[model samples]
Target: MTDALLPNILQFIGQIDPFDKIPKNALRTLATQVQITYLGKGEVIDLCTAEQEKSLYIVRTGSMEQRKVDGVLRAKLGPDDMFGFSVLGKDASSDKGYRAIAIEDSLVYIIPQTALQTLFSAHPDCAEHFASQAQVRLKSALDVVWSNKEKGLFIRTVGEVASGRVAVVTADQTIQAVAHEMRMVQRSSCAVIYDNDTIVGLITDRDMTKRVIAHGVAIDRPISDVMTHSPLTIKPDDLVLHAASVMMQFNIRNLPVVEDNKVVGLLTTTHLVQNHRVQAIFLIEKIKYAGSIKSLASFTPERQAIFEALVDGRVAPEVIGKVMTMIMDAYTRRLIQIAIDKLGPPPCNFSWIVAGSHARNEVHMLSDQDSAIVLSDSATDNDRIYFNHLAMIVTNGLASCDYPLCPGKYMAATPKWCQPVRVWKEYYKKWVSNPEYERLLNISVFLEIRTIYGNSEYETTLRDALHSNIRNNREFLSTLVNDAITTNPPLGIFNNLVLEKSGENKKTLNVKKYAINLIIDLARIYGLAVECDLSATDERFKAANSQNALSDDAFKNITGAYQFILSLRFSHQLEALKQGQKPDNNINPDSFGSFERKHLKDAFRIVADLQEAAKVRFGSR
Candidate 1:
């Protein structure tokens, strides 16, 4: 390559990463040694089972289609996208490897692996970005066959396992005596009131200690005076895991089991810990025991087993979510290591953020991947190169693992989505301060971000800033409310079922998009305004109640709406996964039983009513 053409060649590679960090001299040398290849449309670039090499290929122009061994087109890659870096990694597994072929006449830049490694070593930021991207990709690949084997595990109703022994006290009983009965029975908690075959209140040891002993209040006071009235209770026939969530969310040790408005039994946290048989005991043990990723990977097979256990255990949706989050987190970290081994290293300090359902820690079997990168503000031009490369690696890796790329271009690899921490903060400020239609949409999407890997403190700082900005901005809150209200559940003109325009059940509507998103948006706005730290929509609703953000009636209506939507989504996904179909948000109401349909309709009505109230509150503004 001549000096005159050297700058152009360097510029093209610089547009990618780590290469951007190479000095002018080294880049010129690299340009001289690199090869530029051209291919006509329909030409094969690399076939399946081709000899692997330690080099990277960047498309200078045109596009290519990646295919599987069965000849199915899997992905399309355009200019600026690169491939073949995985050859640099230590992993020898290639059974599920992809083959590349030109879709259109294309020009490509190929760089030797040694040169790329030299660049990465000289510019550590580039290496980091490469590593991060690779890790994300590996994680995605692993998720594909990670196994949901535990899907059929035993799920029994609370009524089936109830001890049939009740520990109860009258609402008029003294707190002192109630505490005595609790301790004498070796129980951490007890139901406070059993009246007319109804459960009116609950009092636990913590409540007694905090409300009476700590406050220096007389223990002789009526239990009703210190009891938690109208406490969050579940029906006896409900899933035990649901009860577990109520306990975890409330930080309580026990929950009252209500049957036909009567207190039947008390469910303790200890009981669940003792009885729940987790299949992937090894995975859980590894996660709890391992202090590093190296150790965590040693139990990778166990991780798969754990996933199977979760599928089979019939664990409550909430617990399943928690477990999945833990596994995914570990998986992502390991992939990052693999990417780093392949790409070399990062150009600068950065954090990989998880968004959407995963960020909220509510991922289901069919969930897609949503993530972004937050680089340090001090990152130089060289840093941008590495970060961009890292993003691509992670996004593509995730695609291989069964998480389809976010159709909305919300993946970490996109420049618009990847930014320095300071830039992200500025972006948040702009969205919150302006609160325009587009900005509001961006805020709604980004606010759901949760730190899944790297520098978690950065995520915390960003979240705190968001809370501070939104809490003080009444106008922004109002705008959010207005935006949230716009997507009201679609109720038919005759107040009957609103059907879909197409699909197997053409007459059925998607409850997730219309109903669930409505509640999620409403809860998000309320939570933001109140500076609630909880991430999940359901958890946010509960937090909103504690903060008195909604009236008791409104709270009940929304809670019921949330539960109905959740149940519907769970069932739909369960059936879809069972049939080997891709789980999706689209749901057909007609497929549901009459009672289920009625509950869904009622939920939508509640959502519609709340939306109207929201409009009245903010639409006028």
Candidate 2:
């Protein structure tokens, strides 16, 4: 290959990923290995197997259509597009059930399998590109900044992924006219109904079917009559994960995105769940219909399967945490409903709440139940008795569904926790004012509360009280920071791993106590110090960094360390489960590879450095 030809190949393939990330010298070398071919229009290449045609095909000019043996169009390739990954899956246990053929007279570049394998081994990031090569890039496929495959394909913002065309109508428009406009326009699944540019409601195909087609509502009725009012909305820049979360959380398919107070895009669940088989959204819907705790328990194997899939795909730990939290949230909500069915409606308005990891939305397979109840001020002694019974049944139900009761008895079943809104406020006020041992413990665990079911306003009352109390008391924040700084990362005399000297997990690291929780504590301290109500560890850290409390290096180091430790801890627990052992935070240092050990130490050092920084900043309380 001449230098001029190599530069041409570099210019062509540079538009793609992994190749774009490769160093210029290495990329030039890779470009030299390419072999070019040409075909006439409507010509079919009998590219049967990897052994027969062991090369990747990249279209240089003209278009081509890849089809299955049975005649289904798999993908249409044009300039810069690549094909022939089906051949690479030769050892995939089965055929990919597809092949490529030419639709137009074209010039294609071919990279041999042997050369690609050598390059992939040389550059690990290139391997991801090879892995995703088999997936058909249909339309508007993007190469985004996402590094994990667990989210699958891309993790671009809603604005980037959402269809650019916004389908909308006024609330006063007739359903007939709305339906006509939908069919005449872009054939949308749903349309956002607005009132003078403010999004007021939404009408979906499901609503049209159930509310109109089934019930036979007049076609000329105002859209406001059947439209869902005050619909859930997402910001244009929000992550696609958040869009999936809101869709699954509310059991809706269409999500409208607002930007600058204008409805800009409507993203469907179809956009999110196209490639995934077992999404949190899908699982949550199943949990909702589960008739009993036993039925919900039956889905435990499915949960394990989902966890294994995410782990095997090498997704970020924060991604897994959010996914698992959705499952925990589903279980909590279902158990509450089961309790409600048996006990009938409560005597007064109340809120069912969850705290700690669940509230933070950073849960994992090993997280336990930390919860409470906030009742309306109108509740009487008899009402309290009813709520206690309800809480007991719900907690017991949750246990049956694999969510264990709180070890510290912080559950709603306890009378001290199942209190009226006014009493809960008083509790927070006293805890903040005192900052004693027990108070500190309780406040740390319960400070980040989230509403799960029932009247959310009840929880809002307690939340406001807690926020108010923290604002007036900076000493308590310092005290919490002081307490937080004491739980140092486990590094021994020689800077080796400090393993447990005794316990069931002897000679193992308690990752939760020593590292994960240490980060959590620091995050909580930072949150309180900045008066940031965010609960997720990464969010809290970022919030602190935004407030100029955390140095740039410290922010990056601590966040990276925290996520890596979480990933390690999750991997350990998952391995334990697969091996028929009970999973815990205890990870044996002997199991660590040289690579893991090195990174683990670096992560610990960051934790220690951050702790010292916090202690110095906050000082002794």
Top TM-score prediction, candidate number: 2
Model 2 scores what on Cα lDDT? 0.76
Which residue runs of candidate 2 sit more than 4 Å off their true CA positions?
Answer: 1-161, 168-187, 194-198, 205-226, 235-251, 259-262, 272-275, 279-282, 492-497
| Candidate 2 displacement at residue 193 in angstroms | 3.9
Residue pairs with colliding backbones in model 2 are: none
Q: Write the per-residue lDDT of candidate 1 for residues 1-621, one digit (tens) a residue.
A: 456766788777755544554577766666866778898998875634547565677778987766656675444556666666445545435435557788789998877778767766776544543432233332222222233344432345566555555567777778888777777763645654765556678887777778888999898888888888877777786656555544543567776777777777777767777778444333443444444445554664454445445544444455566556655654565556556666787777788888877887776665677788888788887788877887776667656544567877877888887888888888888999997887876777788777766777778878988987776676887787767766657543121235566757565566666777788888787677567777887677778778877766567667656754665576676677667676677766446542343344445656776676666655535
By summed lDDT, which 10 consecutive residues of candidate 1 come out lowest? Answer: 136-145
Model 2: how far residue 449 lies from native, Å: 0.6
